[model samples]
Target: MGTRHRDEGVTMAERPLVVPNPNDPRLTRRLKGLDQDRQPVLSDVVVERPLTLYLNGQEIVTMMTIGDYPECLAVGYLLNQNMLLAGDRISGIDYDEEVETVVVRTERVTNYEQKLSRKVLTSGCAQGTLFGDVLEKFREVKLDRTAVLHTRWLKTLLREIGTLPSLYLVAGAIHGCALCAGDAVILYMEDVGRHNAVDKIAGYMFLNGIAPHDKIFYTTGRLTSEMVIKTVQMQIPILISRSGVTAWGVELAERAGLTLIGRARGRRFLVLAGSERVIFDADAGEDAGA
Candidate 1:
């Protein structure tokens, strides 16, 4: 099932798998307060609430999110945690908004008892927790190294995502991740945490049967190992961020042969890994201020 509730933003929520609905009143709140100078001030703040996820009969994790895409968030969390295999057939996804709970049922006999016994923490905010040895699967993923990310496509992508009417621009405390095919965004998701944003996209992709080989992942958050692992898990060829990268993230990208780009804003970006796939077809003056 798709997002049960949605409202049109300036341009988001129009097409694509999903996009931020900044105009959705439930996602934010209007608070009345006074400034330091004794002036009346009204502020729009993001609404963060608990969302508990269940894979089959077992509880997976309870994530704090903006509460729009509960179904995607639930399924994506299980997949990102490696609790749900990509080949696993999902029977149904049940979401109950009143209790803030979502359950994902599968046709295959699902079990993660051993995997659940181990938990690993990483640098991706508090939401960056994973179960068992993700590296075991990480090592086995052979990314399509032949995929290319053209400089011209990168510039267009930066411009497209930056100008999007999103919750980050509407309110201050939020994170966004986009799934792009070439320079065009196919899905743009946002939430209280960057992990939630990316996971929503992952769930959407899985449900829609979208191929990841030629896709690029973009994020407003830092390039942490969590980001690298999630992008690699999706089998996307390129990962770009308008923020800096962590050391472990770069190491993982190098190992996976994933094109990792960071500090991508206004015509300046650094490719720390898999530079062989970047085709520099654009000049410095072309979209220089993007």
Candidate 2:
């Protein structure tokens, strides 16, 4: 999540609000700008709103979100939390922007209490947290070890998906998450919070009946514990990003047997876990860094 400041001397109406721009040139630009001082300013204001997930008129979880795609976030959060068995279970979602809340209607009351009770706090910029023992469960996930991805295909996927339309492109202060199958980017989402973006993608995937195992997850944000857990929950074996990863995230990915590739800039990348899935070019020689 982004941050904003209001001077005590200035009134709230008079203060300048800085918002986040996920598409800032500094991070997304193909070429660095010559006039560094004249760079475009991205907003830093983190959009905060409450999302209420309801099952048969009973409230399940009231989440504090960055509020962009409320429906997707609600559904995705439920899916990640293991409260949702299938996308068809969600009957409807109603948003009340005036009250800053979203109401989700589901077919059945999913048993989410156990998962919710295991919340583990983290040190993320936002109020980032996760459910405990979730990482341990990932250890049981058996992936197809020989599912090789070519270096050329990886580059193509990144380049093509990187140019796709996003909330970051419009707001400049958001994070983007996408699902790529084969050479096509099937879904893309952006939000003021990285978690929200991931949730949106997850929700879309769920609603569309897209199997996670055959797809690769991509993001323009840091690979944190929540990010790793979300990917694991989706059963997506491969995750690629242009950002860095946390120690715990790397550990979880390794235990979950996921192929995590980070720092995917241009022709280079770092595979923090499940290196066997990434097949380097023969012409690049055996010296190619993993």
Candidate 3:
């Protein structure tokens, strides 16, 4: 058996990477806590484990995640941080449960000492970090203008998101993200932090060679600068959430021409940026221009 990478660059197993079961007991623990009525009760809580990612044997950064799809997290985190190049050939991904680490091996030598030296805490709930100016490439990046989101399709997607079985539904302390092709969700991931969910989805897209231009990204967390930047980096145009958006997020979305939709729940939702891409067939409203 040899290592495999996508795009015929490296070789992997015929079967996909072994992703941890979302319902795995190891990912959650039974804890004792007091309820609102001050009653002591035992409940299941989501687990947070530290995963240190190494690129080409060099230590990168340790991320606190829910311990699912760690391979994707490692590769996706590196990609979003700009440490991993688009054409970089990934030779292998190795995970050690006892050590709690993930190493991403690439055919090309990778060193990001200078980039990792500079780090800024982002607005992500899990306290996401950024290596360099994550927005540097946004100026040249343009989303597909022809991509359109129908009002009905948007509603259908939200409804589907609500019906999905998630960690949040069971433990009540996680954020989730969904990658949708039209009204169908291709992948759904949840973690203790929203950033982790986004990173997992990014990893899935990267490894599976999924295109982003026509996909819709939905998150259970508020739309922040970090979320907006990561979504754009994924080259996804439409971002929707049941929560509200921040000023910086709105500004960035407008500049990058990314369709930003937030506060979406039920029949009431708002489109804050890239309004022209939204088709009002269901609502018959005016174009949601920036």
Q: Which stretches of candidate 3 lie over 4 Å from their true place?
A: 1-22, 283-290
Tens-digit lDDT track of model 3 for 1-290: 12234333322333243222557887888899999999999998888999999998899988889888899899889889888767777889999989999999988887788887889899898789986657686566778898888887777778877777777877888998988866677788888889989999888778877678787999989999899999998899999999999999999999989999999987778999999998877655353220
Task: State the TM-score for model 1.
Answer: 0.91
lDDT of model number 1? 0.84
Best by lDDT: 1
Candidate 2 per-residue C-alpha lDDT over 108-180 given as tens digits, one digit per residue, 9 for 90 to 100 = 6555656667887755445656666556655666765655666766777777776775545544666778777
TM for every model, in the order presented, reads 0.91, 0.74, 0.90
lDDT of 3: 0.82
Which regions of candidate 2 are displaced past 4 Å? 1-48, 60-66, 86-88, 111-115, 123-125, 282-290
Give residue 107's error in model 2 in angstroms: 3.1
Tell how far residue 113 is off in model 2, in angstroms. Answer: 4.6
- Worst 10-residue stretch by lDDT in candidate 1? 3-12
Worst 10 contiguous positions by lDDT, candidate 2:
1-10
lDDT of 2 at 111: 51
Candidate 2 accuracy as lDDT: 0.67
Estimate, for each residue in 1-290, the C-alpha lDDT of model 1 and write its tens digit.
33222222323234455688889999999899898998999989999888888888888778888998887788788778787777777888988888988999987777777887898877676547876678788888889877898888887888888778799888889989999876788899998889999899988877766777778999999999889998998888899999999999999999999999999987789999999999987675556444
